[model samples]
Structure formats: C-alpha cells, structure tokens
Target chain A: MREDFQDELTRVNRTLVTMAKAVREAMRQASSALLTSDHTMAQQVTARDAEIDVLYRVVEDRVYDLVARQQPVAGELRKVLTALQVAADLERMGDLSVHVARAALRRHPAPAVVPELADLFREMSTVADGLAAKIVSALADQDAVLAAQLDRDDDAMDHLHRELFSVMLSPRWPLGVEAAIDGALLGRYYERYADHAVNVGHFVVFLASGKDD
Target chain B: MREDFQDELTRVNRTLVTMAKAVREAMRQASSALLTSDHTMAQQVTARDAEIDVLYRVVEDRVYDLVARQQPVAGELRKVLTALQVAADLERMGDLSVHVARAALRRHPAPAVVPELADLFREMSTVADGLAAKIVSALADQDAVLAAQLDRDDDAMDHLHRELFSVMLSPRWPLGVEAAIDGALLGRYYERYADHAVNVGHFVVFLASGKDD
Candidate 1:
C-alpha cells in the first residue's frame, strides 16, 4: 500500500511539472502577443488557459483522494498539501498570462505596447520567463536551493515593474492616458505572474525542508 | 473523539469569521484613506495587515494539525481543506486593502483619488465592504445560498471597474498620467478583492453541498 501510494504521489508531481511548463509557455506566448499585437497568439493563449485550469483540478482531486485513501501523516501529508499549493500558484500564473493576452486583445489592430515601453515590456517578459523556468526545475527536482533563488530572481521583475510606471509617468511620455493605463496594468500582470512563481518556489522549499520557514 | 474534532472545527470556523471581519474593516479604512488622503489612517491599515497574516498562518497550521491528528476523511476532510482556502482568500483580501492604502500613502498630502473619481471610488468601497460582509456570514453560517449570491453581487464591482477605466480614458479627463495609472491600479486591486471574495463563497458552497460546482 505504501509503495502504491508513492507511485501515485510521483505521478501527481509529474503532472505539476507539466502544468508549470504549460504556464511558462503560455506567458511566453502572451508576452509575444502583447509586444507584437498578434491577435491570434493572444487568443490562443487565452483559449489554452482552460487546459491549465483542468490540470489544477486534476491535482486537487488527486490530493484529496490520496488523503482519503492513505491518510498520509506528517511529512507525507505536508508533501501532498504542498502539491496542492504549488498547483494553485501555477493555475494563477496561467490566469495572469490570460490577463496579458486580453490586454493585447483589448487594443486589437493597434499595438498594445508603445514604442517607448516596448523594451521595458520585453525585459519584464524575460524576467517572467526565467522565473517560470525556475519554478519548473524547483518542482521537478524538489530542489530547495533552486527554489530559494526564485525570490532573488523575482526582484528583477519587480524592478522592471517600477521602471514601467516611472517611464509612463515621465514628462517625456508622449502616449495618451489610455496607453499609460495599459502599460501600468500590463506591467502588473507580468509582476504578479512572477510573484506567483515565487510563491510556488516557496512551497517547493517547504516540501523539501518540512519546515514552513 | 468525533465530538472533540467537531468542537475544534467550530473554533476554526469562528477564526475564519473573525478574519473576514478584520479584512472588511481594513478595506473600509483603506478606502477612507484613499478618498481623504488621511495618511495616518493609511498607515494604520498597512500596519494592521500583519495581524491578518497571522490569522492566516493560524488557520493553516491548525488545519494541518487537525488533518494529522484526526486523519479526517471524505466530507470532513473536504471541510478542513475548504477552511484553509477560505483563510487564504481572506488573507489576500487584506493585502489588497494594503495596496489601496499604499496608493494613498504614495501620494500623501494630495488625494490618491481625484475629485472627479471620488464618488466612483466610494461606490467601489461600499461594494467591497458588502462582499466582505457576505463572506463573513457565509462562513459563519455555512449558508450556500448566501455564498452563491456573491457572484451576482460581484457584477457591481466589475461594472465599476470598467467605469473606472472609461473615466480615466475619457477625453475630458483632467488628471495627468500619474493619476490615471493610480486610478487604474487601484481599480484593479478592488476588482481582485471582489474576485477573491467570490472565490471564498464558492468554497463555502462546496463545503455545504459536497460538490465543486
């Protein structure tokens, strides 16, 4: 029974890693859509979000099932609960990606990002992509060290987020209020996506260390 | 043993209700600070956020302890899990309130919200307060009917959120880009607070009905 339970746990972990990968790809595509104003890619990212939600549900049900069947205690139980949290953070990351895509769609036929802010958005996207990749590796290997580093990596995203606001509010900013609002909100989406990734990393650290610190 | 477990669950539910009340109060104060630019009130709201975070950690730890000690299964296990989720949502609501307060603090001496949008912000605050109240009652009573009503109630917040953007983007808008950005981000924070409240309501419905839908 113990061995069977471990097998199921392993399968659940694999699903989490797969969900992370899907979220990473979603954000990457959503960023491209926003920068290039590619309506099709933006729509694709929004549509594919359902798949990530489905994966989240899968993880949730399996964790509950494991709890009911095996009554896992102590460390094993913490591992299961952490899996649930990691999946939830990934699910939210997926939603944040959709928000970026929808922002692109909202300004369809026109560029969502202005030329002045394009480089900043590109940098934010790069930081977001790197954070998502780290989340994948942290979950797949249960590497607490890698997970701990996501916090520092997320700082880059935050820095870019502040820069986005500064640039939009600059006197030289030639864009109208509409573009400024779009830039502010889009920067928020990427920043939040990175925050959620860091949250997942913390859960991975807890799973590895069996301590909530 | 079963009765003892029931008593503990009741205590956890009460903690959740208390946490909800605290979050509601935080948003109320935060809104007042934003509209009035009352720096002291804003500081108080930010300072007290740590208390909400403490309550959230309490809920998390207690739920884990209950799971380990009792190994609750089936419906009871689901109840425990739902409690964890409800606490998490409430904790996030507290953070959203801080976001509003910080917006106010960032522009101290000058109102965070311009006079043009004051009425609209007041309305958003009212809706947010209403949502938080519903969350409290829903958790306290485990009233699925009341919980289900939150979705429709949230539409008011959504409408206000859209109106916020329209007001900022209007050709006649008198504010500069900084105020527009502030308005946009503040609106997003309030909208997300409403969304999290709705999420908690869904969890309450699940707890009462034994169905995820």
Candidate 2:
C-alpha cells in the first residue's frame, strides 16, 4: 500500500512536468504567431489552451483523490499540496500565452509587435521559454537549487518588460495609440508568464526544502 | 478530537474571510489613489501590501498544519484544500491592487485616469469592490448560491475592461502613448482582480457542492 501511494505521488509530479512543457510550447507558439503574424499558429495556440486546462483538472482531481485515500501526512502532504499550486501556476501560464496569441489575432496580417520592438519581444520570449524549461527541470528532478534560480531568471524577463515600455514611451516612437496599447498589454502578458513560471518553481523549492520561502 | 479539528477548520474559514476583507480594502484604496492622484494614499497602499502577504502566509501554514495533523478526508479535506486556493486568489488580488497603486505613483501629481475616462474607472472600482465583498460573504457563509453569482458579476468587470480599451484605441484618443499604456495596464490590473475573485467564488462553490465546475 505504501509503495502504491509513492507511485501515485511520482505520477503527480510527472504530470506537473508535463503541464509545464505544454505551457512552454503554448508560449512558444504564441510568440511565433505574434512575431510572424501567423494566423493559423495563433489560432492553434488559443485552441490548445483547453488541453492545458484539462491537464490542470487532472492534477487537481488526482491530488484530491490521493490525499483522501492515502491520508498522506507531513512531507507527503506537502508534496501533494505543492503539486496543486504548481498546476495552478502552470494553468495560469497557459492563459497568459493565450492572451499573447489573441493579441496577435486581434491585429492579424499586421504584426502585433511592430518591427522596431520585435527584437525586444523575441528576447522576452526567450527568457519566458527558459523560465518554463527550468520549471520542468526543477519539478522533474526535484532540484531545489534549480528552482531557486528561477527568481534570478525572472529578473531578466522583468528587465526586458521595462525595456519594451521604454521603447514605446520614447518620443521617437512612430506607432500611434493602438500599437502602443498592444505593446503594453503584450509586454504584461509575457512578463506575467514569466511570473507564473517563477511561482511554479517556488512550489518545487518548497516541496524539496520544506521551506515556504 | 473531532470537535477540536472542527474548531480548527472554523478558524481557517474565518482567516480566509479576514484575508478577503483585507484584499477588498486594498483594492478600494488603490482605486481612490489612482483616480485622485493621491500620492500618499498610493504609497500607503503599496506599503501595506505586505500585511496582506502576511495574512496569506498565515492561511497557508494553518491549512498545512490542519491537514497534516487531522488527516481529514471527504468533505473536511475538500474544505481545507479550498481554503488554500481561496487564500491564494485573495493574495493575488492584493498584488493586483498594488499594481494599480504603482500606476498611480508612476504618474504622481497627475491623475492616472484622465477626466473623460474617470467615470468608467470609478465604475470598474465599484464592481471590483463588490466582487471582493461577495467573496467575503461567500466564504463566510459557504453560500454556493452567492458564490455562483460571481461569474455574472465578473461580466460587468469584463465589459468595463473592454470599454477602457476601446476608449484608448479610438481614432480621436487625445492621450499620447504613455497615458494610453498606463490606461491599458490599469484596466488589465482591475480586470484580473475580478478574475481572481471569481476563482475564489468557484472554489467556494466546489467546497459546498463537490463539483469543480
């Protein structure tokens, strides 16, 4: 019975890793759609978001069932609870990715990211993807050190977020109100995607270290 | 022992209600700060956000202890888990309020909401506060009916969010890129606050009905 419970716990962690990978792919597709004005790709990202949501539901239901049946205590309970929080953070990352995709769809054919700002967004995408990857590694390996590093990785995303705003608010910015608003909201979505990835990493850290810091 | 566990559960619920109240007050202060350009008030709101974080930590620790010690199952376990999710949503609501306050600070000595859009933002603020209040009532009473209504209440917030965007994107919009960006982000912050509130309500519904939908 104990071994069976342990297997269930391992399965839960594996599911979190899978969810993180899906979110990373969603963000990747969303970023590509935005930069290239690929309407079909953007539509695909938006549609696949429901798949991420389904994975989230699966994690939540499994955790509930495990705890109810096993009555896991101490370390085991913390791991189960952390899985739920991590799934939630991953689910929110998927939503933010959809937000990015919709921004692309809203200005279809015309790039959602103007050319001058395109490089900046691409850099943001890199950082976001990196953070998501770290979340997967941290969860799959239960590496608290890797998880702790996400906060520093998130700093790069934040810096890029501010850089995007600086470009938009510059006096020489040629884009008018509409483009500026799009840039602002898109910057927020990418930044928030990084934030959720960091949150999931923190849950991994908490699970490993038994420290909620 | 069961009676003691029940009392601890009651304490957890009460703490969630208190956290929701704090989040509501934070949002109210943030809106006032943004509209009035009250630098001091905005500063206060930003500084006081830690208090909300403290409340969040309290809920998490208490819930963890409750679950580990009591080994609750069935409805009791669900209630404990739901409390954790609700506390997280409320804590995030607090962060969004800080974001609004920061926007006001960024444009200190000048109103964040221009005079023309001031009425719309005020309406958003009212809806945001109302949602927070409903979260409090829903959690305190465990009223699935009241909790179920938050989705509709959130529609009003979504409408205002889109309205704010439309005004900023209009051809005749007088505000420059900076102000438009500010408006876009502020609208998003308020809209997300409502989203978190709705999430809390859903958890309440789940707690009462055992249905996650």
Residue pairs clashing in model 2 are none
lDDT of each: 0.92, 0.90
- Each model's number of backbone clashes? 0, 0
True-structure lDDT of candidate 1: 0.92
The sequence of per-residue lDDT tens digits that candidate 2 reaches over residues A101-197 is 9999999888889998999999999999899889889989999999999999899999998899889989999989888888999998988898898
Model 1, position B50: C-alpha lDDT score: 99
Off by over 4 Å in 2: none
Candidate 2 per-residue lDDT, tens place, B1-213, comes to: 799888998898899999999999999999999999999999998999999899988998899899888888877888888888888899999999999999899888878888878999999999999999999999899899999999998999999988998888888887798888888888889899999999999998888788877
Off by over 4 Å in 1: none
User: Candidate 2 at residue A97, lDDT?
Assistant: 94
Top candidate when judged by lDDT against the true structure: 1
**Local accuracy of candidate 1 as per-residue lDDT tens digits, B1-213:** 899789888989999999999999999999999998999999999999999999998998888888998888888998898898899889999999999999999999999898989999999999999999999999899999999999887999999998998899899998899989889999999999999999999999998898986
